[model samples]
Each structure stands twice: as C-alpha cells, then as structure tokens.
Target chain A: MSQRSAGPELLRLIELMARLPGFGPRSARRAVLFLLKRKDQMLLPLADALRDAGEKIDRCEICGNFDTVQPCAVCQADGRDDGVICVVEDVPDLWALERGGSFRGRYHVLGGVLSAIDGIGPDDLHIGPLVGRVEAGGIREVILALNATVDGQTTAHYVADMLEGTGVEVTRLAHGVPVGGELDHLDDGTLAAALRSRRDVKR
Target chain B: MSQRSAGPELLRLIELMARLPGFGPRSARRAVLFLLKRKDQMLLPLADALRDAGEKIDRCEICGNFDTVQPCAVCQADGRDDGVICVVEDVPDLWALERGGSFRGRYHVLGGVLSAIDGIGPDDLHIGPLVGRVEAGGIREVILALNATVDGQTTAHYVADMLEGTGVEVTRLAHGVPVGGELDHLDDGTLAAALRSRRDVKR
Candidate 1:
C-alpha cells in the first residue's frame, strides 16, 4: 500500500481524506500530496476552516438547516412568508431549493425519509418536529418537497396523515416530465404521471 | 449559487477545497458537506492530520522525497543496497515503486522531468545533487525508473549524458508488453518493443 513509505502522520491524513465523499484511496493520496505541496496556500487554510466549521456550524433549532446561527439564516430572515413551510429530506435539499430562488418560505428539514429496508420509521426522521410546528398554528400551507422515490412517497403520505386534523393545506411537488427533458428519453412511469396530471394551457 | 446559504467560513472552505487535485466545484461542496455532517469522526481528525502534516512533513535533504524526517525513510533505511540508486520523476513515482517492493536500492527524486514546452530543465530538477551523490563514490549503477513518455526518456538520456565519465552504469526500465496484458488490447509501440526485446526461454 506504500503506507509505510510516507510517515504515519501523512498516511493518517490520506486515510481520513479517503473517507471524504468524492475521494477514494488513489484520489485521496493525490489530494494529500497536493495539499502537502501547497502547505501555505491550501493545507493550513483547510485545516483552519475545518476546525472553525466543527466549532461554529450547528443544526438550526427552528428549521434543522445547518448554519452558524441557532435559528439559521432562512428562519431568521425578514420579508419571507412565515405562513408556508417547505419540508425537505435533508439540508442539501433545502440548499437546492434555496439555489432555485423561487421558494420564499422557511424550510423544515426532515432528516431523511421512511425506509423499510433501512429500518427508518416516522421517529427516525424529523417528522415529529414537523408535526409539532404545524400543530402550534400560524402555518397555512406545507409543501412536501421530498424526492420522487418510493421511500419519499411513503414518508410524504405518512406525514400527510399525521397532519390531517391540523387544518394545514398539504401540497407536493408535481410529478411530470422535467423542464428541458425530452419525452422520448423519459421512462414510462414518468410519462404516465405527466399524462395523468396534465395542466390546462393558460393561453 | 446558494453559496450565501452556508456561512462565509464554510464557503471559503469549499473554495479552497475546489483547488485540490481530484475535487471540482460540485464535488468540493459535497466533500465540505460530508465533513460538516461527520464533524467528530471525520472532520476533526482530518483537520488535525492536515495540521500535523503541514508542520512535520518536509522535503528530504538527501533524496528530495517528502518526509517527516530529514533524510526520509528510504534514504535512512538500513539493508537496502546503497551502491545502486533509482532515479524517478516525483514522490508519487517513488511511492508506486515502494508499493511494488521489488527494488532494494534507494531513490533520488528528480521532482519533475525535462519538458522544453514547459520550460523545465535539468537545473530546475535535483540533477546536480544526484550527480554529486554518484560522484562522491559508492554508487555503482543508476536506474532511470521514469515514465515511458517522450519527456521521461529525454530526461533519462539527459541524466545519463551528464554522468558519462563517472563510471556509473546507467540503466532504464525495459520496454515490453505489460505483465498479464492481452496482445489484442496492446498498443503498437508496446507490441513492437516486446517483439524486438524478445528473450530466450531457459530450459
């Protein structure tokens, strides 16, 4: 493995680097070497950043989004519609929705969806907190922006059932052909969904 | 770009991570998020490892390899043949050779090969120090274990020419079809080299 060639400390760095999402063993080695080469410019700054993030970044108390602040920027921001709440699978989904710049409401991050195979149930996700938010009143609408997967749908239905008597209007992202998608390349399931939920033309 | 969603520290971390060899903008974001998610297990350890490596790891005085020690592990190791020196293009090449565990000689890292197009010459490399090591007398043979590229060979020849009258026997890695390689998928140059350097089978 050439693990012994580079000292133990450097090898440890490579091992930890390999654990990162996009890096495998080979790429991790390359990354560690690159970091070593640019110690002043990259290595030191990254180390400092990681330490700072570990200390500063935390889950938002209100929305479950990650931020340095307790309530998170989205929850604390002014001029946003406090009446609507977008429920997403995780922080990344919240970030994706924010990147679109369309949704003006705050978000409630449901840590993950209900997965039967993975042993994840209602309690495993942030569904309890979500229901609590809706039950406390003031929220008029809740958008279930979960992924269009089997687990996601099951979780969405489960959440909807939980909020039945709460007087909140539940909605979900539309299932159809994606914007800029070619119908010929789409699966039969998506085509069928698009046909069933066909919207009327405004013109 | 949703860059503002994450705080300034995290955004800065992502920016620096994008400069790493294997990570691009998208993957850098994924990596940063992954680190943030696993703060105690992965993030803290990685940050500590980087800081340790940055503080300890430096170029070996004798061999030019990156190491926590002055002469590096390979240069300081006992039982290796001190009389034969293996010259390579970079630290990764040295690590690759070490992983193979075949060569028992020490190495001299050239840092880079001669590239006229890139303005890299002998002086830019550790060629003078290598010659000095050979001239000081114990080295009997020098193996040019560089890559089989045009620049690698040109650098090899340049190094050999510089050591002309030093009584050091200069050698290079033999060109052939790679071990366990199929003939059909082999390149023309490799097939030709394998055929021309055909060796007699021992009875």
Candidate 2:
C-alpha cells in the first residue's frame, strides 16, 4: 500500500486493479506482480483484451446486454422465441438464465431495479423500452425474472402494472425452495410460499 | 463460462481476466461487466495503465527490481547504504521489506528460489549478478531477507556458501513469532526458534 516502495506506474496499475469488484489492495498487488511475471503470456494478452473490449463492446440496443454487436448475439439469434420476453435486473442474471438453458425466449435487461434510496426511478431503467417492445408486439408473455428483494419486487410490480392493458400476460419467476436446496436451510417466507404453491404429483 | 452467451470480445476479456491471481470464472465475468459499466472511468484507465506498465517498466540492471528506469529508483537513490545489500526471493518481498522502512540498504532480487521440482537452478535466479556485485567491492554485508520456507532457507544457504570467500559478512532475517502475533496461534517450529533465540529485556 506504500506507493513509494514500487514504481509509480506499477503502483498506478495496482491502484486501478484494486478497483475491480472483488480485488483489494493486497490482492491487487499480487495480481499486478502475477501479471508482471508473465509479461508475454498473460500481461500483454490481458492488456490487449481490455483494450479490445473497450474499443469493440457496446450495450445491445434491443436488450441492453453488452456485446460487440449492436443487437447482441442473443437478439440476433433466429432460434429464440420472439413471442416471449424474459425481463431481468442485469446482464449477470441474463447470463445465469441462459446458462440454465430452460428459457427459449429473448431477454430485456433492466440494468438495475427501482431503488428509491438511490434515487432510481423507472426512467433510470429500461422499463419504457420494454413496454414499447411489448406494445409493438408479437410477445405473448413477459416474465419478470427480477430478484426477490424489495427494490426488485417494486420494479416488477410497476412494470406489470404498466403492461397490463398491452394484452401480454405478465408473469414472474416462482418463489420456492431452489432446486437442490435443503429445506432446513430455507427461510420461513420461502418455505411458506413453496408450501402454498405446492404442485400435484402425476403418476 | 458459456462462451456463446456474451460475444467473443467480451468472452475473451473474461477469459483473460480469469487468469488474474484471485479471479475465478464467475468473478472474472463480474469484473469484466464492472469494467464495461465504467468504460470511461475505470476500463480505459486500467487498459492504459497495463499498456504503460508493459511498455515503460523494465527490470533494474543492477538490482533486478522492476521500474521505469534502467537502474530502478532504489538503486539510483543516493541516501541508501550502498555498503549493504538485502537479498530477496522476489520483487514482492523486496517491496515488503522496503515497506517496513527499517532496511536502509539496497536490494538484490533473486527472481525465484531454487526449486528441484520446478527445475529452477542457480542459473535461473540472479545469484551470479549478486556475487559479481560483491566481487566488484565496497559491499560490507549481505542480508538474506528471504522467507522462512524450506526453499527459501535452502536458497539462503546456497547464497551464503557462494559468497563465502568474497570477504562480505552474511546474515539472515531473525526467526521468531511475529510482533503482535499470539503464541497460541504460532507454529511449534517458530516457537522453538523464538525460545532458542530469546533476547533479554532491558527492564
């Protein structure tokens, strides 16, 4: 953390690396040293990657997902169901859902939920654009795959209300014990919701 | 982890980011998204920093410490004790010792310790340059401020032996329980060394 110990450029590299989501000063220094040690193999390639990403990547105009393409590969893909749209809070959630591979529909990224404390309103998100996509039309359903947090729920409810008269059926991800999750570790609210929404088993 | 979900450039960025010391696949994706979000502020600066460090930084010819200068800032500093050289296993250790602010001497970076399993020998390190420095004269002492690991101790012994007939006094960092460390949490070897090398209190 003492800047004078290492050179200014090296110190600056560590400082910027520390700004990464999970990196602290110590881990940043370690990462910088790691990069320094593997200059040709790792450092140069990483730098090139960063620069290339910076220059090439942009938010998808249709879904708000970041990609090199304007509409994004997801949006550009012809195999997905255009009749259904899955609304998510951020790109990570979109990626997670895609990884699950169950949903065949396209996605609409909200960028973030409506947080009054942080002064985020509907305008701050991609809500208007979502409504426009639904209004313009072939979408039969819009699934709100937002987090179950207060801000997320509020945003979902607001979006559902806005799209009420648009003829599209607004739905949400189910509230239940996650698959492979233990009942003992489940919270009371989730357990109660799961019990209330229990499905009948078919032979 | 799904390469096709995010575009090629973004995927490549995440792949390179995953190679960083502490980042895994998930965290690398998060870090990449974080950079994407703060394109002008964080991403560009980090890219610039990496490129600058890659282009400008080089190992000091005399000490092997990485810096923008050929001799490095430490080797060029006029106030430090030129008569003493603190030998370390790597640049991180050199930085750590410098951060302590107790060592007024210059340093010699060994790059790495001799590891039989890794096939690292004496030639792989900067031991030859160190001996050359001592042989050139004016150096009164050489402190082996290496780690307490087996390889570190082995390297220290090897270095001591190499500098045996050169008329330079050789020493090592003291082996003891670290300051502010609890005795109960200390290892038996450290405790034994501390006990055997106990210093008398003035009071």
Candidate 3:
C-alpha cells in the first residue's frame, strides 16, 4: 500500500475493504483479487448489495435495531411482549441475542457503553432514550443483557440507577457457566461466578 | 445467518461479504454493522469503489497483471529491460516482486502453476504466449521466480523445457536462507540448501 503499483481504482477498493473488522492490508489485497476474478458473480452483486443496504437500512425508532422500517421488524412484529425490554450495548449484541431465537421481549440498544477513557458518557449513548422508553409506562422489567466488560457493567449499573422508582424491576444477565462450556476452557472469573451462582437441581 | 433478523438488504450484503476470503458469518455481520453505522463515510465509498474497480480494472493482455490498461503499467512502463523477463506464477507474485522495487526487467505472469490435483496444466496457463514471446526474439534471460513448491518447480521445469532451443537462458531463484533470517528459526531444508550453496566471504 505504501508503494502502490496496482490501478488506483483497485488500490482504493483494497483500502476500503481493509477498514473492516478482521481484514488487514494483505488480506484486503487477496480479497480484492478474488473479487476481481469473479467480477459479475461476486463483485457486482456485492457492490449493489452494499449500496442498497446503505440506502435502505436505518435504525428502528423504538429499539435502535437496523431495518428497512422505522420501528424495525422486531418492534412491528405481533406477539412479542412490549412490557419487557432486553437492553444491549450495540447493534451486533441485539443481532446476537436474536440469533438465539428465544427472546420474545422487545429490545433497547444503547448504541455503546460508558467509557470514560473514550470520553463516552450517558449523553453519548442512547441511555436517555432508554429511560424515556421506560418512563413511557407499561414496561415491567429491564434486563441488562450487556457484556461483562468494565465499561459494559458501568453502563448497565448506570441504566439501572436511572430506571429506579418506576415500579419496574431492573436486572442484569446472571453470571454462570455457559450451557456447553467446559470448566477447563473457562477463565477464573467465569469459574468463580459459576461456583458462586450455583443453582439447586429441581428433579 | 440461519435465523435472519437484520434487514434483507443488509443480510444480502453480509452474505456476499462472507464469501470473501478471511471473512466468516460472524465477522461479516460485525462488518455490516460497522458499515451501517457509517453509511455516508465508509459504506457508500466502498460500494462505489467496488463497482468502479470491477468496471475499470482488467487483466494486462501481455502480462496478466490486473490494471486499468490492457498492457498494464509495468508492461507499458518505459526504460524497463525487454531482454530479461521475470516469469512469475500469479499476479500476487508479480506484485510481490514489484514491491521489492528492484526487478528492473519485464515480467511474464503465468497465471498459475501446473497442478494435477487442481486440474491445472500448462495449457491452462499463459505458457503458450510466453513461448511465443521468447520465440519472437529480443528476450535474453527468463528467470523462474516461482514459489519454492512442488508444483512451482514442476512448472519451472516444463517452462524451461519449452524455452529450450529458443536461444534464451532459463534461470531460477536461489534456494537458500533468506537475508536477515536466523539460522535457529530456519527449516532444515532451507538450512541444508544454504549450506549446500554457501559462498566464500569476500575479505
């Protein structure tokens, strides 16, 4: 990239592709070459898809989930409980919970966590919108399905503090061993949490 | 991806992106989310770049390198030695050699090596054109700068055989320890090669 030899157009494509989460300069070059090889099959469709997605996908007005609609498909869908809300830190977290295909309650995406180092406070996130959603009435519970990182926990605690005295129970995701997780593979913190939060077998 | 919840257009974008090398479903989803967050800045420009690169970039007619021009920049560049050709296995290899900024001679991209398992043969590559180039005259040395692999060596032999009696000298890259390579970290084969091809130190 420092010594550019390829066409400017191709190099530009590599530069942008390298901005993705896992791609580096070397991998981006390989990906570009691969895409160029399958111009009609892969490159054209991908270009069209990227543009179309960018044009259509917008955040849901209610939950901040990305969709082609204002309120999102999750918010618009019937039978999902509006009384209970599962709060997440980012869009990827919301999508991750959706992948489980079990959560039937509505969702509230906070956009990001509270990071003092990053100068991200409550105002930087959608915490105020969340509190407003809670204050709108009829919400019974707010499950803080946030990550177990320091920033994530701080954000969850702050959201919980803001949502108090509203006659609604605020909760955080339980610390325990994952369903198929091995004790050997788990870290000391997870193991300790698992041991501390042990539940009795109800046979 | 199996339990799709994101917008159809966004999901389509992820699906196409996942097909790219080094991208899996999870990373693709994360990338799509990242792109959606910066619609105007990253996503749109990437989409435009993809389309533009695909439309404009083409393989060099003479060297098989990807570029906007038919003969490519390297092939058309003035003052490059036409008497010496560095034969490479693919575009990336050609690019790698060019990155050194030392190979002043012209290049001949073979497109690929002769692989029996992959059903790749000499006819599948640009060997015919290479032979034609040598037979047409003006070329002196044909450096086999192919990778140090079985298929590469086999292809080098085949090319060398083909170039015989064409009045052009066929050479290969030296097999030895790389410059600045530590002997302890080097493989046995490379160490053996380095020892076998050792040169007297100039006083």
lDDT scores for all predictions? 0.90, 0.91, 0.89
Candidate 1 lDDT over B35-79, as tens digits, reads: 888888998999899999999999999998999988898988899
Question: DockQ for the candidate 2 complex?
Answer: 0.67
Fraction of the native A-B contacts that model 2 recovers = 0.69
**Of models 2 and 3, which has the larger TM-score?**
3
- Among these predicted structures, which one has the highest TM-score? 3
List iRMS (one decimal) for every candidate. 1.4, 1.4, 1.8
TM-score against truth, every candidate = 0.95, 0.93, 0.96
Which residue pairs clash in candidate 2? none
Which candidate leads the pack in DockQ? 1
Q: Cα deviation in Å at residue A134, candidate 1?
A: 0.7
Please write out the lDDT profile of model 3 over residues A68-163, one tens digit for every residue: 988888888888898999999998888888888888899999999999999998888898888898899989999999999999999989989999
lDDT of 2 by residue, A1-203 (tens): 35555678998999999999999988998899899888899888888989999999999999998888878889988889999999999999999998888888899999999998999998999999999999998999999999999999999999999999999999999999898999999999999999998998882
Residue pairs clashing, model 1: none
TM-score attained by chain A of model 2: 0.96
Ranking by DockQ: 1, 3, 2
How close to the true structure is residue B54 of candidate 3, measured as C-alpha lDDT?
Answer: 83
DockQ for the candidates, in order: 0.72, 0.67, 0.70
Query: Given candidate 3, what's the lDDT at residue B7?
Result: 68
lDDT of 1 at A76: 87
lDDT string for model 1 (A92-115, tens) is 788888889999998999988999
Better of 1 and 3 by DockQ: 1
